[model samples]
Target chain A: MMHHHLILRVVTKMLVGTIILFAFYVQFHGDFSPGGGFQAGVIMAVAFILYGIVFGLNKAEEVFPPWLVHKLAAFGVLVYAGTGVVSLLLGYNFLDYNAFNPGHPSHGQHWGIFAVELGVGITVTGVMVAIYYAFAGRPPPINDEDW
Target chain B: MVETIINIILFTMLVLTALAIVRIDSLFAAVMLSGVFSLLSALLFVTLDAVDVAFTEAAVGAGISTVLMLMTIALTSRTQKKATRSGMVPFVVVAVTGGALFYGTLDMPNLGDPNAPAQLHVAPEYLAGSIKDIDVPNVVTSVLASYRGYDTLGETAVVFTAGIGVLLLLSGLGRRRRKDEEGDA
Candidate 1:
């Protein structure tokens, strides 16, 4: 009787898709809008959290496996930090996008930011999914015997 | 005059909500009130034109954090023991520390001043040229991912840590089928 309600599942799935699309818009349009990596990341995570709540932890894991999430989250940060390290190796200040290109600093900055935002989005979504799985799979109370 | 009245009302509500958090005996009610407090604070941030901060506060503080806290409380305890004064020294120290932090805020830039040091520095450069330079419409994204990518990388690392921590904590306990069968046996 305490299982996830059908309405909750339907509503949450709809909301999750909407939130993901919104996050995509925000991330891509962040160069001119109020949205940024942090906001987009939070919104992206929210979708996974909603899904976990509505569909159950096992189902959530099936969609975003814990192992895959772990690796993807780590890879995301690595992609971001690796960009900076590459710049440093190229003989510029760490994270200096200018070093990413031999010319046109503006283009370099654009490319760098885009890559980093993608990384942020990936890490955010993955970790949020992981958190949902963690909290969801927590052992329920030993009182289910009454059912 | 209306703006002044609105500010006054907002301030009063903030204070009353803080008091409500302390006064509420029910843990669930306190958690709900805390979410309201976060939403109000996010609104205050928006009024200050710190839209980015407002968005984050709304999503994290009011949304995810509240739900997480409620889930934790459900998994843990519904009723809390009455507070005792026998070991209140830490509370006093933390209160004093927090008060000191609040006092330090007096030195911060006046709210919404476009000429504030924060706005005049790298932020302005980013705001003015990010679109032309980055080919993106949202400057916040450009700054976060490109101009200040190192910091974003660190934030992602923090997220990675959280994920790992969750996996480590929950892995063994998740063998629920085996546990259930063993329990039944």
Candidate 2:
């Protein structure tokens, strides 16, 4: 039953890489484009979730273990909060980007935005994947034929 | 002219999809129709020149949420149970709430109105200052990450809290598996 759909498995294999690449593009190119951390993060999570759906949950879990997913989720929040704390330590207002590069405030803003967006991306990806795992891990009460 | 046509088509599709979802007895069909609804709304967002929102709606709404709903259906029943009670009271409540909401929209500014309160506020400064201060071409990103960093931070925290809550609730499965193994040993 697991390997029943050859087309789905093969197609997912081809699509996964492209999805991840697009997610990265959306993440880094966000400053110049319509996407940002949130959209990018969702796209990234979709890749993993797609993999899980096609290849079965066990294989996907092997790729990204639950423990790691939980850690990554918390770590993203820490990274975001840490950036603000750093600015505070530097005697600037909370989340003041000017503190990152004092001579060129715009450069500092760029760096600060990049870092915080990265944090947002990471957290969102982790949270989404974790939630998917939570839902998919439970055994369905009904059989496949019922649907 | 083209934009108006596109908007009308998309909105019509959205209304039809919503009606189909309401009329459908099959849970799976409803889920699929909701995904269609999301895709239509994403197209609407694109026509409105909010590509980021469109991208998010397409990905999260059409993609992830559909998958989540399907998973939920797997866990539960595929067909919705027939309502034993009449839906009149609920219908009246919905109509009243929707009417009030529609009434509220009368006070809202027309689309793309320059004199709108939203456009008259700090948005102009953000648009003007973003390139000079943040040096980002995407003013939305600059505004979200720099100008309103705290608000985004709060949003992130909210996502974090929700994830943790779901994990706490559903994480019992792993413990149960471990206990089963111990019992076997």
Candidate 3:
């Protein structure tokens, strides 16, 4: 649908890689920085959404299928809850990180935080992309000239 | 002093953008202006030392939402219907709410007051305990993930549920429904 927009396509192709790289940075380095899973996930979703906009929704869906996106959205929640369940099984309070590393509780905290943040990131990315797909797949009621 | 000046500039821009959004009849133009409004709010958040919030606002508010709204505009009407009724009711409600909010602020602490009740409350202990327990350089992460992990878990579930809800409502484009309808027919 956006085939004639060569400039947008070229610019998006260039920016997508950098956007993905920055999203990863925001995701992993969040513990020491301002960003975390939520912001990183949105940023990550932006990369794919931009690609979908410049190219076409079908190509974007092919790269990341809608079924996979739905599964991912749920899987992220499982990853988050599973961490707490692990702590519970290990004889610590739910979500208590001390269960991970007996000798160093702080390291345990780090691991637990990382796991949950990853879960949050995955879920957010899935949801955002899925919404984008749903919206873009629909037939437009009017032409560009209507606006 | 410099921060205050920057804030004033951002706030002015924000008001101007909001006024434009309200007055504009073209939904597309309104959507674009709202994106600018979000960007300005993100900048204001930065001045307030809330970079994490600013980041989210910039990404979700300015970037993702703009795309989403544009898609919505495509699916719906391009121009908004003019309101047939007078705007007096909404104006009175807004004025009353704003006045009440201004009154409520009179009892609140000033910006960054050292002796504010919130500063003396659990915030101190949370800060101290976070350093000793979590040892994460970013206290916000530790607080959200470790200290208030249950809340974070709940929030994730909410996000998950929201995605499910949207899928249920807007997945009309999906072929599964059509195939099911055909089979039933």
Candidate 4:
């Protein structure tokens, strides 16, 4: 159904890769700069969302299925909580990174922050994309000419 | 001096955009204007040295929010209807609330005041401890991930819950309804 816009399709094809690279950069480089999980995850979701807008919802869903998105969202929360659970099992207070490295608290802190941020980034990405899919998938009741 | 000029220019444009959003009758135009407003706000946040917040505002507020709003408009009407009721009461209420908000700002410390209560409390500790504990240069990340670990866990849960709720409301119901229609057909 997406027709008549040759320019948008070409441009999006070129830009999507760059956008994804930038999202990863923001995700990992956040410790040194002004970005983190929330920002990075949203950026990551934007890549897929832009692709869906330029192409079509079906193609986007083929690349990233709804069931997978739901699993990733649930799994992300589990990763976050599982980290705390691991810490508790190691005979430390929940989420105390000192448990990760008994000798070096700072190193433990680094590992903990990384894991936690990864979980956050994953959950945010999944949730945002899932929400996008849910809204976009609704059958359009109005005529296309009405737009 | 240049910063002040930028601030004044941005604020003036921001107010103009808001006024235009209010006056615009076409819902599509209003949605685009709101995206512009968010981008302007993100820029303002950047100028205020809040780059992290600016990034979020730009991505989520301008980017995702604009897409979602456009999709919502697609499923609904494109034009706003003229108000049938008197606007005088709502106008007075809005004016009073706006005036009160402006009045409240007078008692607050100026931006970046070193002696402000916020500056004196755990913020300084966070700034200092981030380097000592997390060994991270970006204090915001360390603070969010380390000091406020439980709080972030809570935030992630909230995001998860919200996503599930939306998926249930939109796709879950819509899918079943569509199946029923197909069966009937």
DockQ per candidate, 2 decimals? 0.52, 0.85, 0.87, 0.83
lDDT of each: 0.76, 0.92, 0.90, 0.90
Instruction: Score chain A of model 3 by TM-score against the reference chain A.
Output: 0.96
Q: Extract clashing residue pairs from model 2.
A: none
- Candidate 1 per-residue lDDT, tens place, B106-151, comes to 9998877788998888888887777676665656566667666667
Give the per-residue Cα lDDT of candidate 4 at B12: 99
Residues B1-185, model 2: lDDT tens digits: 99999899999999999999999999999999999999999999999899988998999899989998999898888899999999999999999999999999999999999999999899999999999888999998999999999999999999999999988898676799899999999
Candidate 3 residue pairs in backbone clash: none
Residue-wise C-alpha lDDT for candidate 3, range A1-147, written one tens digit per residue = 766778888899999999999999999999899999999999999999988877889989998899998889989999999999999999999999989997999999889999999999999999999999988888878764444
Identify the superior model by TM-score, candidate 2 or candidate 4: 2
Looking at model 1, give its docking quality level. Answer: medium
Q: Candidate 4, residues B1-185: lDDT per residue as tens digits?
A: 99999999999999999999999999999999999999999999999898999999999899999989989988877899999999999999999999999999999999989999999989988988999877999888998988999999999999999999988888867778899999999
| RMSD from true fold, candidate 1 | 4.1
Displacement of the residue A102 alpha carbon in candidate 1, Å? 4.1
Per-model TM against the reference: 0.82, 0.96, 0.95, 0.94
In model 4, residue pairs whose N, Cα or C atoms come closer than 3 Å (at least 3 residues apart or on different chains), thus clashing, are none
Estimate the Cα RMSD of every predicted model relative to the unseen true structure.
4.1, 1.7, 1.8, 2.1
The window of 10 residues in a row where model 2 chain B has the poorest summed lDDT is B166-175
